[model samples]
Target: MKKQITSVSLGQNAKMAAALYVVISLPIVLVLAAILAISGQAGQALVVLVATPVVYAGVAALGTLIGGWLYNVVAARVGGFEFTTAEVKAG
Candidate 1:
C-alpha cells in the first residue's frame, strides 16, 4: 500500500495553532499580563492579547508538524501503517 501525504489547512491550522498556544501559554499569559498590568504595563498586556492569535497560529502550525511527524514515525512502527494525502490530477 502507498503511504498517503498529510495536509493541513491554513485557517484550520491557525485556529488549532491558537488553541494549542493558549493551552500551552495559559499560565504564562495570565501571570505575565497580570504583572504587566499591575506594574502600569497594561499597554503591553493589551498588545500581547492582540498578538495572541498570531502567536497561537504559529504554535498550532508547529504542533501540527510535530503531531504528523510523530504519527508517521511511531504509528508505522506500532501499527504497521502510515498515511498520505497526495492527490493525483487527471488532465
Candidate 2:
C-alpha cells in the first residue's frame, strides 16, 4: 500500500527546529570564540561569538524550509515513504 502526505507545516517546523539547533550549538560556539580569543584573535572571536548563532539559525531555517518543500513535492508524486512493522516479544 502507498500513502500520501497532503501537507507540511514548513515554516513552523523549520523555525522551531532552527531555534532548537541554535540553543544546542550555543556552548560550542562559545568555546570556539574563547579559543580564538586565547589565540590572540579577539576581534574574530567577538565576531564568531556574536554572529555564529544568528547565521546558523538563519541557514537552518532556510534549509529546513527548502527541504520540507522538496519533500512535500516529491512525496506527493512518489507516494511518501514505505515502511513495515512486526511485533516483537521482549524476553
Candidate 3:
C-alpha cells in the first residue's frame, strides 16, 4: 500500500519533540553538571542540571513547530511525502 503525509499536527509534533529532546539531553546534561560540580562550581552545576533540559526542550519544540508549519505549507503546494508499506504475514 501507498500513503502520503499531507500535513502534520504542529502542537502534537512540538510536544513530542520537546519530550524527546529532554530525554536525549538528560545524560549529556548530567555528565556536564557532574563535571562542573566536581570542579567546585556547584551553583553553576545546579543551574545547568535544572536548566539545560528545559532550554533544550523549549528550543526543540519551537523548531519542530516551525518546521512542521513549513512542511504543511510546502506539502500543500508541492504535494506531500509519499511512501509505500506492506503487511507482513505471520511467520
Best by TM-score: 3
Better of 1 and 3 by TM-score: 3
Candidate 3 RMSD to the correct structure: 0.9
How would you encode candidate 1's per-residue C-alpha lDDT over 1-91 as one tens digit per residue?
Answer: 3663444344565566667777877677777788889999999998876666567657677777776667657645666344556678999
Candidate 2 collision pairs? none
Candidate 3: C-alpha lDDT: 0.97
Q: Write the per-residue lDDT of candidate 3 for residues 1-91, one digit (tens) a residue.
A: 8999999999999999999999999999999999999999999999998999999999999999999999999999998999999999999
Instruction: Order the candidate numbers by lDDT, best to worst.
Output: 3, 2, 1
Give the per-residue lDDT of model 2 (tens digit) for 4-59: 45567899979997898799779989999999999999999989987898888888
Quantify all predictions' global Cα lDDT against the true fold. Answer: 0.68, 0.85, 0.97
Which one wins on lDDT?
3
- Give per-residue lDDT, candidate 3, residue 5: 95
- Candidate 2, superposed: residue stretches over 4 Å from native: 1-5, 82-91
What root-mean-square deviation over C-alphas does model 1 reach? 8.6
Q: List the candidates' TM-scores in order.
A: 0.47, 0.74, 0.95
Give lDDT: candidate 2, residue 47. 92
